[model samples]
Target: MRSSGVRSASALPCKVPYRIDIADPPDDALDLLIELGALDIEQLAGGLAAILPDSVQPEAVALALRSASITVSPAQGRDNDSVWLLRTAPLRAGGILVVPPGVDAPEGSLRLADSEAFGTGHHPTTALCLEVLAEIIAEDHPSSVLDVGTGSGILALAALLLGVDKATGIDIEPAALEAAAANARLNHLGRRLRLILGGPEAVEGAWPLVVANVLTAPLIEMAPMLVRRLGHRGRLILSGISTTLEAEVRQAYRHVGVNCTASQTRDGWIVLLGQASW
Candidate 1:
């Protein structure tokens, strides 16, 4: 997340640029650009397109974003507001609709606030995780869930809305936990959603189901701990892994006695479902 009010510390040009391009931006990308006075913004395929004031150079804004690991490329263009004018439509994760906070949403749709944390439902992994989560919940009716690396708490929140009794969201980043907490409240799931500002070790309890949508490496490293925290007949959903690395991640869990019973792939990303092989 951008500091509340940080004076420009990086080298940036003085003239404001008209257009900005961001590739693989974080969840807070849109919020940050909007905060940076972007005239308008649109989601791109694994990127972002933002219209900024042409009066200033793109250097400052670009530098500011790079500090947060988001690259902002200068893409000057003639006024084309019409290009992104019709994107207010909501996105879907399973049967749940994803809309920005305060936007008109059908009942039960997620009204996610703009956040710097991840899991804004823009990524394919997040949507895939939700699709699998919905299916698992529908089939098993698990009462509670543990969401590891719960960025915006979208997964845990969705679990509650999908009929799970309670959810605990864990994230190593404090900012992520904060974002998740706020989102839980936004959807009135705060009371049912517990936010933990640390890794899985911060909490101790076996869960009927656990969902972790973090990247491949962390998932591999945390395989044992996560599997150990599952109750009898527990189910695990692991995502954020690329198709190329699917075998490596699956092997890591299988090494700890997990039998991945199902898997799905989308846009080259993969999600896996596993159970303890007793």
Candidate 2:
């Protein structure tokens, strides 16, 4: 499950929407905005810009970016509708059709919302994970799945739609769990999906299929816990790692006796498939 950002200040009766414009933002500054839950980010000649919700304070965001030496300025307020101008496009991954809510999906397609929880199916990491999941399911059906950092619960929900009997999604953020639950209901898979509000420790039993789409540091840090949650002969699909960190992540899991069986890379992001030898 993905982590949540800091809660915003209490909402006022009326609020003005704003965009935070960063001048000459470095890669680290841009990453900071993403981690802080900036919904829409755009590249600019000067630096970068992000559209934040009305609830978020531009000053607060600027303060945070100060450490990275990025200068943030707030643009004039705009209509809320402009925030979602870039609608999420439908993604066809393997046998799954991931569409945003209210959009028409083909029969058997999975409908998800573009919520704050992440994993809308458009990201390279999520797409790579989906592709890996589809391949594995086609080769051998898995009875159950455990989705770690289940942002938007897309990975776990997709598994159920692809014939997995049941799935459990774990995340450290309540908002993510809420979004995942809503998506499960949207896809009409609520009964077969269980949402948890914690990390790997929140999961009690091992699963035949486990997928975690998280960054390299967290993935490496949770290697032992993740391996423990994988049933014997089970398959583990890990993503949200860059090509440069592939070796480091592989070694981390190898230390726990799991070997990378396959890997797929797209747009510099890589996903690894692993299995433990009994």
Candidate 3:
């Protein structure tokens, strides 16, 4: 799942950018920094360096690095914009078209901009979700959809393009909501998509299809609520779960009487598809 922690980093006042230079950074070190809201990152002579927002105290970052057992030091004056180089290209996931910003979307493609918000269809979680979503549409053709934690509204918008009559997307981060709205307009699905600014609590009624591509912990916590939003015979697609957590996540939904109907895995990430017991 995309962390919302970095959503507001751009709003924080600019202060001295702290650089954390690592010699032989661990494979997961970059993931950890991204999770902790690093503003920018670059490769350096010995290894990699990340520029953290001023709001993130250096001590906190150092502690995180130590916890990961990654060797790092604060390099006081180095700055780089290479982080922005990380961009999403047009992705063909299932029958969906995921086009990055500034790139023209071909016919029937879903246009999304590169922003701090997540879900550019680059992440495996998103790709897995889109695949299952397309399968569901082809099999059941659910009339409506609700996308929880809809980062860039990619899932919801894709559902619309794939023939779902309408879709609703909810996110706790204002930046994500803003990005989703822009993406809806980009795809010309603004009228068919509704962007909400809160979690499931902000949504009303039920949907024939629902998708939540959030992490395992939050997925477990919201299991009941998400299940409740499903209409009779409705389907739920849950992703952003690691393979190790698959059973645990499935049990969470099972506890709420939702049976896992299908599953797909890619790059160690798993997506579980469920349907409420009739």
Candidate 4:
């Protein structure tokens, strides 16, 4: 939670620093770190550790990373997890501005913008959703997608890129909506992407594909509403719960007549895919 020198806007795309310290490894340690945004594998020096940025000079950062020095290693091999890369084009949603990426938006394309909320295909929940979205597009090819609790609009944007006819995203945070709107514009998906601020209470409709990557308790509480918003044979993907809580989440969804058809786990986090029954 501390830094050495002042970092200008250009120096760090993220306003916040990306240093996470974990004392002891828990049963699901790595997953927890990923959830907290430790994407680049760094070294462990003494009991403290440093998670440097993806662009930080390894040798220099490694020395800085090691204070009292004991051990260290770069976090790597993240591709093993269920994840997909996305390419976004510049777009304008809600009349907000967006800038296109210097690099191409991945195969599936959509509007582009940035947000303050955590996700934009960088986190595990969003990553899992993208992979699942790709599979769904390949198989069922649903026409519409509803991303509930759409933090940073990554899920909904992925749907648009995958040829979804339309995508509607809803979130409770104003900042998140702003971010979603910005991302939509950045990807040039303003016409196909709609960003709304609020929860399920904010909108209603049956979408062929619905994804909610929120926490376990909230997901379970919103199960009824999510089920009601799915078209017949609609698919649902739920995540943000660790593997330890998979059974409980599955049971909760089952109680609401949602039968989980498949599941993917990364670093102990579970993403459950299900279908609406009745």
Best by TM-score: 1
**Candidate 3 wrongly placed segments (more than 4 Å):** 1-85
Best of the candidates, lDDT? 2
lDDT of 1: 0.78
Better candidate number, 1 or 2, judged by lDDT: 2
Tens digit per residue, CA lDDT, model 2, 1-278? 22222323343234544455566555587788777777777777877767666677766676666633333334332111322323466779877998877887688899987777778777788889999999998887999999999978999999998989999999988988999999999989999999989889887888889999988999999999999999989999999999999999999999999999699999999999999776
The pairs that clash in candidate 3 are none
Cα TM-score per model? 0.72, 0.71, 0.70, 0.66
lDDT of 3 by residue, 50-130 (tens): 767667775676565553323333333311221223235577997987877677766888888777777877678888999
**Candidates' lDDT values, in order?**
0.78, 0.80, 0.79, 0.65
**CA RMSD, predictions in order:** 11.0, 11.3, 10.3, 10.8
Residue by residue across 63-111, what tens digits does model 1's lDDT show? 6565343434444321112122213336898788888877877889987
Worst 10 residues of 4 by lDDT: 76-85
**Model 2 worst lDDT run, 10 consecutive residues:** 76-85
Of 1 and 4, which scores higher on TM-score?
1
